[model samples]
Target: MTCFPFLFGKKVSSDVRRDPEIDEGLSGIRIKVYTYKQLKIASDNFSPANKIGEGGFGSVFKGVLKDGKVAAIKVLSTESKQGVKEFLTEINVISEIQHENLVILYGCCVEGDHRILVYNYLENNSLAQTLLAGGHSNLYFDWQTRCRICIGVARGLAFLHEEVQPHIVHRDIKASNILLDKDLTPKISDFGLAKLIPSYMSHVSTRVAGTIGYLAPEYAIRGQLTRKADIYSFGVLLVEIVSGRTNTNTRLPMGDQYILERTWELYERKELVQLVDISLNGGFNAEEACKYLKIALLCTQDTPKHRPTMSSVVKMLTAEMDVNESKITKPGLISDVMDLKIREPKKKIGLETFPSSYNASSSSDSQGTTISLAASSAATTSTFTLKHDQSM
Candidate 1:
């Protein structure tokens, strides 16, 4: 293995080819191959000042290509458990797909052991940083803008699930993965955990991976991944977008700590509109906002079969099709499944009637077990990359 240097202003050879491992991993993928030196210079030697985001896989830095196009460069950490396979997976998945709502892959750098992916930079960052981060960002998310964002994300997921030759399941669909451009148009980023399902396959049985708050009950417990898993996560994100809050906020009262649980309580009381972000301040259409919440409930039904398909969700959102409120049922709440030890309600919501059937101590397989970052407040626990087992 050839060793590469990360020092600033240090001279490096520009003639090196892609690593053999990377070449084999990205055999069929057609994308620009960026040299380590080029990226080093593009990012000002990966200066801390230029760093835009950090996650379990690696850190993302703002860079400018030779063509003068601004880019978000994701540098894979050498210490990360996500190795070359994930690096190639991200490229293979995104390079083959294109949609206005999906992040555009500019290229990648795979010289020696330095693995990096370059993407088009979005000015506003992700929904987690701006909307859910709570006043950390100056960007404002009005009701109309939030509605457009939700619809755009639905269309993108619809494209991934239906229009692609081999349907793609976005394993991780949290707020942090949803990026925003200057127009506030939502673009789904981060494809490292994406899985391609052949037309005939019902589901892919794999190790569970995803944020605790956004993970589907079936996928998290049984490890059987399908498009429905993405739908469940999307359902959680929909609520987050509507309410302008994180899925699980420990700061709130125990009963309202989980967004899905709280949404259900409000739904039963015939006041779903109350779940909308108060920041909207009477500007949003109450009926429309409530409709979106109902659609979210439909997507998050306890039974995966009950969840509407992404295409159906798009129609529901656009008012082309009605959201069948009759079909909405209690959602599979992660907090309940994980037993976050909520203070029992004075009048326990209908939730207690349904016993925890899926509560297993741990995964049976030696594969990674789920980690609930929502349960912890450690400074190192980044909501962005808290999906996989940290011990891995």
Candidate 2:
């Protein structure tokens, strides 16, 4: 393989080769293939001053393209477990998907082993940064803005699940993966874990992989993959937006209660007010909050079948349904109570239910199981039973 230099002025093996017969998928758009050195020069050698954030895949840098356009460049690390195949898959998936609520992929450079994807630079960064990070207290989003984001994200997912010839399931749908433009509009990003579902298939079986805390109970425990899996993730993201708390926080006294559990507990007790972000200072609409919470609970229902389709979710968000006459019920957690199986040799994993300090590099066996990484503090442990409850 011929070696290529990266935007960081580092040498890397180039695995990309030209094949006249190969389909580029993105045929009409002109794409300029850049050598690593050229990208590095354009990005000012990937300076820390331009660094945005890092993820399981690789570090993302803010860079200027050769055309003098600002962009966010995701440089895939060669050592990452997500390899060339995954990189190529992300490119193929994103290239075919286009929506106002979805991030746009400007281009990519796949020379040798060095891989980089360039995207339009959103001035507002990610939803996670704007909402959760403490640095931006003065930045308050009104209820209308929040509702727009929820609807926009739902429409984007609806497009993926319904409009696309082969439905797409975004395996990773977290706050960090949702970006914001200058107008504070939400745009879904990070298609690295997306899966294309055949038109004729109802579901696909696959290994369980996703951010902790956000995985649907059925998908996490049974490895049953479906578009509803994306709905479950969207539910988690919605709750995060409403509450402004990280899904997996060790700071809470209750032993590592996943955000869903916490929200459920609060909602059941009529303490829904407590779930809203304190920063909002009770300024948000009560009806809207309750409606969104109900929608979220419905989405996070343990059974994939019980969850509403993306189309329904979008309708609910837009208030197209008769709000006054609507009757919604809490979706109960679904799992075999007797089984209550827990994957043993518990080590810390990613952003799911554990803190970053916990080791995330451990690999899981093929049984679609993972050990709990909750802290041993007695105040946090609660004995709860998994019941086969159904919700719609």
Candidate 3:
């Protein structure tokens, strides 16, 4: 294993191949790859002392670089489903994307079969940790700060969806994926399951990949993916942020009530304020809270088209809106609500599995066609004015 200094260092072997196309998108800086042994020493030979956290993919270790810069290194398990392609995709996507509310990918290490991603160390771990701790000392976050986080995340997503040359959809957006720095500024992380959507296409057919509770209904049930799917996930995240609770955590009361159903019930009863985190202690802006809740409800609606675009969501969050006079649209009855009593057969579709005969991939030059407008309309009780168009 070769070791290199971080500051005023001599360049090591040039075995690393540089792809000009990929390098052009980067910040005109080449990341120095660290040998496995160097990382082993920095992480104290992957000792428990340096272990920060663990997730489905792998364990994260806190390490100090030779320059004394602290970083969080995610060491992927050999058996993890996310392989080289997915890992490289995450690095390419996150590195090109620069935003205050999005986590920064410092570099990556790919030594033989070993894969690791290094990111700037965030003092505060994740929103899930804080929300799950039941208002503990380090978990304290004012309602104002939470609201700002929501706005920041919305901006980041909007940039990904609208600004990127080929729009990208973060297939897995959740509380655990949102990291916070020492200043409590929220940054969206995790892009292992993201998909790049070409500008000409309306939707992309892909495997249903995401946490169950956070997945959009259409994507989960029908294998249809779109930017609105991200909106739905963001909606779930919004409720979690406002209420300071996990969607799937049954420990909280109300008969294992999912966040969507609980929020709807509270909305109907005009007790939406009750759903807010008690930690707020009435210090949050009531009008802003209601507005965000309404936007979230719209996003979580069963129908994907009914959900607002990322740009629209950003406007609703930041622009001056007369909440007192605004009329919110109610969410449609979700299919899961009906399926709670009856189980349905799973339908597999997309590149990962056999493609569904119902639709074909749309080409850039072709005019998109509508495949199953009636089926789409009937699937959700929520109605949208937009027409369903597909092309291949």
TM-score for each prediction?
A: 0.83, 0.76, 0.77
> Model 2, range 1-392, lDDT digits (tens) per residue?
11111212432233455322222422333345566776787678989777776544566778888788888877776676544556656666676457899888777776556677788888787666667654454567877788888899999999898888667898877776778888989888877667878779988877565555566766655566799889988988888788776665534565333567777777778776678877777889987887787788888776568778889898888888633323334544432332223332443323221111001111221111222322222222223233211110
Residue by residue across 1-392, what tens digits does model 1's lDDT show? 11112112233223457668776666555567788989999999999999887655567789899999999888877775446777877776787478999999888887888988889999887787788767767988888899899999999999999988678898878777788988999899877778888879998877656656777776655667899999999999999989997776655677876789999999999989889999888889999999999999999999999999999999999999988889999998554433222122242211111000011112211112323221122222211222222221
Tell me the TM-score of model 2.
Answer: 0.76
| lDDT score of residue 260 within candidate 2 | 72
Task: State the C-alpha lDDT per candidate.
Answer: 0.74, 0.64, 0.64
C-alpha RMSD for every candidate: 11.1, 9.7, 11.0
User: What is the Cα-based lDDT of residue 355 in candidate 1?
Assistant: 8
Q: Is candidate 1 or candidate 2 better by lDDT?
A: 1
User: Model 3: per-residue lDDT, tens digit, 330-373?
Assistant: 55434232111112335321222111100011111011111111
How many pairs collide in each candidate, listed in order?
A: 0, 11, 4
- Candidate 3 TM-score to native: 0.77
Q: What is the Cα-based lDDT of residue 31 in candidate 3?
A: 61
